[model samples]
Target: MSFAKWIGGALGWSFGGPIGAIIGLAIGSLIDGTAQQGGFLLGDGQTSRKQSRGTHNKRPNYGKQTQRSQTQSGDFEVSLLILASVVIKADGIQDQKELDFVRQQFVSMYGKERANHAFRLFKNISQQQIPTRKVCMQIKQMMDHSSRLQLVHFLFGIAKSDGIVVEVEVKQIYTICGYLGISSRDYESIKAMFYNSSDNAYKILEITKSASVDEIKKAYRKMAKKYHPDKVIHLGKEHQQGAEEKFRQVQKAYEQLQKERGF
Candidate 1:
């Protein structure tokens, strides 16, 4: 597929806000003799003008009754690119292993052709200075809870790709988690997956060692439900592998607790 078609068709709510601006800048740098210069594809498959005219002013409606719009694959893809850049540069050095991990993961999830297109965009994105708070706040507003959790999981995966997740990378991710409105508990739960600790299982389950058997079971059930692969089914099968990995980690954590507790 053409780069324009791939980007134009893949995004939805992400085609607006801070995320959109980041993407716009990336596309501007990448667009050359091959692609159209005057317009690009919007999520709806329409040709947008030089700017995303109608969308720049649009804000996510916030309320108890207002529901977040579903996150499309393109939205998730672009978000991942931007955040991965943030984590990779957190230590002031871009490790090749981390960059390879990003490419490999995209290839596994999106196939070779699409992965190439994504990497091209990612290269451009990595060169720019991103506003982490504004980008993350837009994501928190536009994306659903499960999708946002999935994002955190992926960011941790990116940070850990280089064998060891550096302290700076961890700090960057923690800041992102806060900006994304992920609670400390949920952040710790996902963070536990990438590190080894004596109480990692408890942390993965969002519980403490002092908890009773009943609480262990309860936390397991809650975590299982929260990390279920089905939660991100709307993003298509490409994402199920990562979601399943998270779900399996939750199960393993619960099982470890079960073996230790002997109940």
Candidate 2:
């Protein structure tokens, strides 16, 4: 079943607190009066749940996950909606550039059909008040390290949509990472991709500005190897595409440095 259908079942309950009601309103607003017109997109999700349950029951014993993680993984789309909402609001207002960046990413991954539902979910999510740290804590507990890392990566991309990551945005990502039990350095590395300044190319390549040309080239090569989308191919096509975004940044930084230093 599509992730969209899986999300409707948990929309009102998963978030909890004031935001839970807010999220319910969000979904309700998008889905209102349209059920008769387009019910499939806003399915009650009973079929999706039954299908998922059946699939879980059939999983080999050795590969089975506890019900807890399964529940968490099932909420992946909802979590992204919430987390992306928080990031868009981090700078005190919703910026079109950020929203468009996120929208384009969703469209790229889910295609026009599903991306419409996703964009609606995201659009609605943008209108609510998010409890950033609490939700981050929940995400930390439910999601694995790799998934969290990718979430932060997407957040950074939104933060940088305006050409530079402002202080508040950076602070927000750092705070979320802290709550997520992720290392600050990992956030820093992702941050480098979006915000470039005087010597940012060097930073992106993880090399010193004063380093020898040979050393810079070596650093670029190493970064390319490390960030290649292939490194994350196991995560799924969407993630592989997102990784490609980071990989492109690495390539661009290297090329810019190469031009400046005549490498």
Candidate 2 residue-wise lDDT, 1-263, digit = tens: 44344444423224443334555678786554345444333223564355354343232222233233443322455677788888778778888888888778877875676667777777777777777876776666655665676788888888888676788888888888998888765676677776657877777777777989889878878878777776654434655777777788878888898899896
TM-score of each: 0.87, 0.68
Q: Where in model 1 is the C-alpha error above 4 Å?
A: 1-8, 33-67
Error of 1 at 216 (Å): 0.5
- Which candidate has the top score in lDDT? 1
On the 0 to 100 scale, the lDDT of residue 130 in model 2 is 78
Q: Which stretches of candidate 2 lie over 4 Å from their true place?
A: 1-25, 32-34, 37-51, 54-74, 197-235, 248-263
Candidate 1, TM-score vs. the true structure? Answer: 0.87
| CA lDDT of each prediction against the hidden true structure | 0.82, 0.66
